[model samples]
Target: MASRRIPKAAGCSPIRAVLAGPAENVITEKLILKPAPETKTEVVQKNTSVHNDNWFELMAINHLSEKLQAATGVKSMKSGYESLVEATAMVSKIYNPKRQQELVIQCLDSAIPKIILNMIKTLLPQTQFTREYFAAFTTVFFTWLIGPSEVRESEFNGRREKNVVHVKKCRFLEQSNCVGMCINLCKMPSQAFIKDTLGMPVNMVPNFEDMSCEMIFGQEPPASNDDPALKQPCYKSCRAIQKHTAKCSS
Candidate 1:
């Protein structure tokens, strides 16, 4: 996969304020409102060009797929992103929303050994450094899923912090096309894993308008009822409505 390098701290850009957290904040959330979903979700699939994934990226994808298989107790013959998505679909089918999220977290816990998580939690104490470091880390390492991204600055506590990752276009979102999958499968689980495992909260703000997103490290996510992302309707081409369909609004 083609990836962009995170620029140095001096090169960080302070863009317009567009983010919200659990607490009241100066920045506001920028979300493109969509029509409310029907009881059924429409899952869509698009034929996109294949990515030239490197060995490391392939290894990461394979490891994650294995972890998901182990968690869901279902084996997949597909490889790369397909296998992971298949496993995720199984997870959505086999459990409630809460349990699905928990199972994904458990998969993450298995994918990443507890020793590393403990070391990170012990060394990084939810400070500005930890947040920025994670932002940069995500930029470098998460390209296999999120596609190319860059580290940007966001206003936090009246100061600019380079703790935001601006995804140019999310590979997962574009591939799945279903907003429900983006939320239940990727967004919610990711936020929970980072906060619970790393001891640093992150709010993943995905812009359905263009499939771009922002990962605001150190910002606590809003409740489900208050989160606009959860309410977003599936794309017109959503195919999940036929396969692995669940409560899209939930």
Candidate 2:
């Protein structure tokens, strides 16, 4: 004897809805499913690679390279890494510790709201005057431009805050390999840009041990005398320190 197979009900997906009753008694269940919206974290995680070929990044590098070259009388023979090193060396040569801070802040002020930042401003209309928004923005932007970073949320003054960005490894710092450059170029200028230009107070703390850094937004920086970054000795691998070992030693 041949066995008869049961027919599935109309408009019912066998995989989505299992039938336990006769075809006539089976409830026609329609499963309407959609892909979930991507969160900011998900979006950032997806874009892990640095967008080196992007026009915004290219323009920013050029603009900053030109400005640094002009300020320090150092020219960039090569793009990217070489330009960064040459510019940093020039900055070291042209200014004392005090003046280095000033020049870096000035250069950043003039250079920031750069193409990428401007695009961010235009894209994220709601990224104003909020620590959380800026933090999220930084996570995506920095991860795109620099490298991967972790965004952490915490409470401040009895309110939930998302203002801390932890850089597992700073590509620029690692490449430049100079404590002075980290302070004068990356740390100071970045803080100044976020605080002055973006109107959000921030303090950048670099950990020389692991080459990690923390960008704390919505926090005021301490005075020079009290700031740890100001007192950090030059990196052992610092080209400036090697070039002027006698002066640095004294």
* The candidate that achieves the highest lDDT relative to the unseen native structure: 1
lDDT of 1 by residue, 20-41 (tens): 4446555677989998864322
Task: State the lDDT at 113 in candidate 2.
Answer: 49
Off by over 4 Å in 1: 1-50, 245-247
lDDT of predicted model 2: 0.66
Count of steric clashes across candidates, in order: 7, 0
Where is the poorest 10-residue window by lDDT in model 2? 241-250
Candidate 1: TM-score? 0.78
Highest TM-score, which number? Answer: 1
TM per prediction: 0.78, 0.66
